[model samples]
Target: IAKIYTDKDASLDALKGKKIAVLGYGNQGRAWALNLRDSGLDVTVGLERQGKSWEKATKDGFTPVKTDEAVRNAEVIIFLVPDMIQRTIWLEKVKPNMKKGADLVFAHGFNIHFRMIEPPADSDVYMVAPKGPGDTVRDYYVAGGGVPVLVAAYQNVSGKAMEKALAVAKGIGATRSGALESSFKEETETDLVGEQTILVGGIMELMRASFETLVEMGYQPEVAYFETINEVKMIVDIIHSKGLSGMLRAVSDTAKYGGMTVGKKVINEDVRKRIREAAERVRDGQFASEWVEEYNRGMPTVVNGLKEVDNSLEQKVANELRDLIERGKPKK
Candidate 1:
């Protein structure tokens, strides 16, 4: 059986007297640092000396220091930086400065799973990944709730890696909801596949295609935006609160029928085949290799793709519609 942990299952005692270094003041880093601090854990923000994050961290009441300095001082190092540069940072700063027997924590499994950032045998390596975005992580914590997290231990040199992982999850408030055990490979592969298929790439293409079809069929841009783009959140909200079948029952019968039928048509067997292919690429590391090459080349394809997408008529219309809605809103 999968080990699912709650706040009662994980105790903060495992983390007592441990000074935490949160390396990266980006959204996730900031959220984790604040949440851990609020949990009565000692936390420090680590950043590049000259970066904008230093100022942001300082403004948030943290005495942000250089990455090496923070790593040298802390017993637990939570690496929250972008994955592309993790190996570099690990080699040049983290590994050299970190103390023997200290814990190395990650929010994602990418670097460790791919063997890009190998820590020494003296360290404990683990992950405690919150399932939601950073904004919601902090927002929910402040509201006395928390997002779920996935916990995993890649190396247990300290013999208490699982305990430390669970402790960190509790410290960040994730155990207030739940923490599920996952392997590094499983988490990394599933996360990549989900983003490339349904979450980011597929949804964007679906919205754009639907909006274009409506506009081409002589619908007003405003109406097309409302149908294809604006109402997506409302539908997704219902799906989130309830399940897929519950969402269908809550809608009009005509809508439910059309959605049930047409959704299959839109995401047909051919798309399913492609989705399998995409997942295969991720599982075999082809996607990760390609992304690394893209990042190394300064993301030329991504830059051009973003420019093309942003310049599309759908985006232009969507911008205007969004502005109109904003203007129509009542002041608080």
Candidate 2:
């Protein structure tokens, strides 16, 4: 069985007096900075430019500093910047200014696993990846709960990398939920595979295809949207809070029977094969290479894809339905 850690398994001693620098003031960075400080750890927010992020950090009561300056003074440095920019920032600012043997932290293993941002051998490289978005993480922490997290160590030059990782997880309130021990490769590959196969790509395609099928079958677009898209959240919420069988039991007998029988027909062996192919692309680094290349070329594919989605009939229908629903809601 995989090792699971709780609040009892972690200690803040490793981070008590350490000067921690959090690079970026975006979603994850802001959450980490706030949570760690709330846990009584010293945190410095670092930004590349004195722009909106810097202003936001200052508003949050952090003495924001330049990236290089933060790295130079900190014993621990957390990189919360976007993956595409990490390599450039590390090379130009962090790598040159980071203190020797400083603990390097990450929320995801992408850059490290892909060798896009390789830390020095002397540093303690680790990850404390919360299992949710930054806003969710912060919300749970404030509510006296926490999102689960994955803890991993890449390099342990300090011989206490895992300890420090757990400590960071605790500081962020992740230990309140649980921290599952993982590795860089495992976390990176699984995250990519899940995102491609189900979370982002698969779900969107499923909804779009379902909507198109209903529309082609002569159903009203609004009705199709309600059935194929809007009710997904309600069903997913049930599944999230309960097990699959529980979700099945909660629905109508017709739904249970139809979903169990016909659902597999829709997502049959061909779909499984395609999903496996996507996993292979992620495992073999093909997806990473393609994404990196796309990013370098200014993300034309991503931009055009978003534009296509924005102009889609499904999106237009969704917007109209949402506006109508909002207008019908009783005002306070």
Candidate 3:
């Protein structure tokens, strides 16, 4: 079983005087820098000299130093950048100046587990990933609560690397919520698969198929939009409060029976086989490897993916769904 380091074990003294560098003042980076600084730790924000984010970081009262200098000066370094560019940034700007035995941390494990980047032998490598998005993490912490987090120490060159990781979690108000232990590989693979299946890929396909089916059977495109995509939130709300059985009980018996019968046929043996295949593609890293490789070749994959997700027909359908939501549902 994985060990979850809880709040009772966290100590502010653990990072009291430690100089913590937050590399990349993006969403996670900004929140971490703010919370860590408020906790009285010496914190610095590192970013390239360009970009509007530099001005924002400065206005937020952090000395936005060059990447190299920040790594050299801080005792602990947290990288909060995008997954694809991290390894490159590390090799170019961070690797050289990283202090001996400096604690190198990440919000995601992409670089470490995949051998995308290797830290110097003298550095301590770790991760402290929030289970939620950046805004949720920050807002919950400000309210004296915290989103759950995952922490792992990949290398302990500092001998206290695990302690430092836990302490940082405390600084960000994670331990008071919950922080589970996971390896770099486990977190990385699971995160990728989760995004590929439940969050992005599978959900998108399900909505598209549902919409097309409704519209093909003579439903108006606007009605199809409401019946298929726009009601996703209502489904999720029911699922959130109750399990599938409870959700079934809450719906009208006619709708419940239809859902039970038609949903099974829609996701029958062939579709279930396809779903398994899709998950296997993620497990084999066909998706991640392609994404990262495309980045190394200048992000053609991201460009294409964005283009597809934003095409005209999809945009029209999405807009119609938004309008339907605003107009309120027709008489049930």
Candidate 4:
């Protein structure tokens, strides 16, 4: 169960004196450095000496140091590296530098829950994962808004796990909107399944299969683009504006009726059962194990899957649609 919080719960200034080391100058790292610096905290970005992000961090007014130096000094160590690489870095660079009772934090629970990165015995392990992409999180902050956040604590070695996690949420500006507490396992599982099944992996396959089905039946590429890919935004916009029924209300009654009738035929109980079974795999940690194993084996299949996407015709069509959308943007 997650204990969620709003703005009144605590103030962001609680981390004022802490030396925060954001390991890895990637998406979450940069955004956190910006937000935490603006919040009047001592913030440093840890990066490889030869890495491009060091220059970017220095340009943005951050103290950029090698991973070892940063980790050794910071009172709070925030691991913002990629999931597959974090554990290795932790074993090599982080675990040794951590002092007793320092806070170990994360933006996501994948590495922690998968046991990829193990923390020191005396430190607290908690999370403050924003429920959006890194760009969205940064953009929201710029607009004086904030994205929803999920905070989790797996350890309380110093009895400040929950409080420290909340402090982290505040530091990153997640408290401007709200934060929810969840288990490391739940957040990790939901996040992975959400990516692997619906958002990226499965949705791409579904969209391509649908478009291919239309084109193989003699639909024009332009028409298929409009109906399948181009209109995706329109459908998504309506879906976001309102629920599924609201989306139907914005469509033709015939289309709605056909959707109600034929949609079930296409996505029947068997299909739903398969989805449930997949969910079961997630709950049972099988999905995490498989993904971790794939990573450990040098990510051959994962690289191949990415190549499959790059070579996809759908990517080509999507790029064209994106260009048209960009072209229609108002002149600066």
Who wins the lDDT comparison? Answer: 2
C-alpha RMSD for every candidate: 1.6, 1.7, 3.4, 2.1
Question: Top TM-score: which candidate number?
Answer: 2
Report the lDDT tens digits of candidate 2 across residue range 79-189: 999989999999999999988888899999999999998789899999998889999988999999899999999999978999999999999999999999999999999
User: Each prediction's Cα lDDT score?
Assistant: 0.91, 0.94, 0.82, 0.81
Q: TM-scores for all candidates? A: 0.96, 0.97, 0.88, 0.92
Candidate order by TM-score, highest to lowest? 2, 1, 4, 3
Q: What is the lDDT of residue 100 in candidate 3?
A: 75
Candidate 4 residue spans exceeding 4 A from truth: 1-3, 329-332
- Candidate 3 backbone clash number: 0
**Regions more than 4 Å wrong, model 2:** 323-332
lDDT score, candidate 2, position 162: 98
Q: Write the per-residue lDDT of candidate 1 for residues 1-332, one digit (tens) a residue.
A: 88899998999998987899999978899899899999999999988766788877888899998999999989999999998999999999988888888899999999999999988888899999889998889899998988999999999987899999999999888999999999888889989999999899999999989999998999998889888988898899889989898788889999988988998998999999999999999999999999999999999999999999899988888788887878866797
Once fitted onto the true fold, the runs of candidate 1 whose alpha carbons sit more than 4 angstroms away are 326-332
* Local accuracy of candidate 3 as per-residue lDDT tens digits, 1-332: 77887888777786788888898887898888888887778898888676877888889887798889888878888999887778878888888778777778999998888788887888889999999888777888888988788888898876877787888899898998888988888888888777776788778888888788877888887777767777888888888779787788888999988998998987789977876777677667686787777767988877897788687454587875675566675664
- Model 3, residue 35: what's the lDDT? 83
